[model samples]
Target: MRIRGLTVTFGEKRVLDGFSLDLPDQGVTALSGPSGCGKTTLLRVLAGLQRPEAGRVEGLKPEEAVLLFQENRLFPWRTVEQHLTDVAALSGGMARRLALVRALALGAQGCRWLLLDEPFTGVDQRRAEGLMEAVRGLRVPVLLCAHESHTLSLADRVVPLEGPPLRRREGEGP
Candidate 1:
């Protein structure tokens, strides 16, 4: 997918300014950056959850993209499975794994892009690694934001970002 000169502003704060990126057709790509640097914003744009003030994203349909947010976003009233208990009953790691699995399934099922925001937050290293392997197995493009170096290391490419007006690190963008 291609994002070119994308601009997104919140009141007076320009979260993204002339930002651009090109993602591979398939494989794992990680976005590594500090908090509040607009990584989530960029992901939202790609997922069509957030509308940018300016710019264009090519080759990705919002409906064809599924985003697993930083939070589990499981409902307290609905059961994910087993029907007896709601999703909130699951432990943090379990919830994260479930969410990741769901996202991967959607992505693999004819979806074009999968966006994950900090998907391994509560999961242990071993399980996280296994989950990373699952992410690598998907045929569609995968763009994820992760803070851990170990997690980033698993990606085919890692793009470092910085800014309220977010941009790629020096020599990192095309």
Candidate 2:
């Protein structure tokens, strides 16, 4: 997706200011920064969860994107299987199960585009690595927010965010 001179604010705090980015169509892109840098806000904007006060975003088809937020956001009443089944009707039951298995392997579950916010938060290294490996195997576009270098390396590109500005770091190519 492409964000052109986007601007966003929450009350008086300017979260993003004339920010622009060209996200690749495939592979993973990591968004990283110090605390309260608006990385999450940018992801919300891309997912249509939050609207930018001013700017243009293009090249993303609404239906094709899925977000895995920082909060589990899982229906506590539903089992993990149920959650995956709920969103995977298009992929069919078998496909959904496979996806779930993959997610569990990665310490996650439930969708493509995989907008993971602090995916490794609180998890031990071994488990986190397992989860990261699972995410890598999905072969779908991924946007991740992380602080650890190991986690950041899993992405195809790591973009550092500073308030409204963003910078890109090279990663192992597809």
Candidate 3:
């Protein structure tokens, strides 16, 4: 998807000012920046949770995308298996491999673009790496925001933000 001259503001402060970006139709693009650089805002806009003040976004829709927030929204009372079963209803009952379950049934939800915010939080680095590899293997495109070096490494491209964004850090080839 492509965002052209997107702008967002709150009160007197500006969050995204004529901000723009182009996310790939396939593979992963990691949005990297400091604590308050509008990464989450951009994700929200892509997920239809927020509307931009100006410009246009193309190539994706609300139904075509899913945004995984920085916090784990899983029900604490539910077991991992239970959560997996619940998700299976969305992902077409894809078989289980390892326990890395976040990306499990999202595909079945018809989510073409997986937008994640610090998806590996609380997970160990080793496990996070494995799960990221699995996500990379999926045919669907991915757009995520993270600061971890490992997560950044997993992306097919990295959009390093400094203000209005900058050039993309091309990953080690697709």
Summed backbone clashes in each candidate are 0, 1, 1
Candidate 1 C-alpha lDDT tens digits along 1-174: 889999999999999999988888888899999999999999999889999989999999899898999987776555667322231478888888888887776777778888999999888889999998887777777899999987888888899998888988778745
Task: Report the error of model 3 at residue 87, Å.
Answer: 5.1
Angstrom error of the Cα, residue 139, model 2: value is 1.8
Runs in model 3 deviating more than 4 A are 87-103, 163-174
Best by TM-score: 1
- For candidate 3, give the lDDT of residue 91: 22
Poorly placed runs, candidate 2 (over 4 Å): 85-112, 164-174
lDDT of 1 at 115: 92
lDDT of each: 0.86, 0.67, 0.70
Per-model TM-score versus the true fold: 0.91, 0.73, 0.80
Candidate 2 per-residue lDDT over residues 14-85, each given as its tens digit: 888888788786787888887678888877887788888898888864445566566555455655567666
Candidate 1 positional error at 40, Å: 0.4
Better of 2 and 3 by TM-score: 3
Query: Candidate 3's residue-wise lDDT over 1-174, tens digit each?
Result: 888887787776677787766667888888887877788888888889888888778898877877776655555566667877774222211222222355546754566888888776556678777777777666789888888888788888887775433223345322
TM-score of 2: 0.73
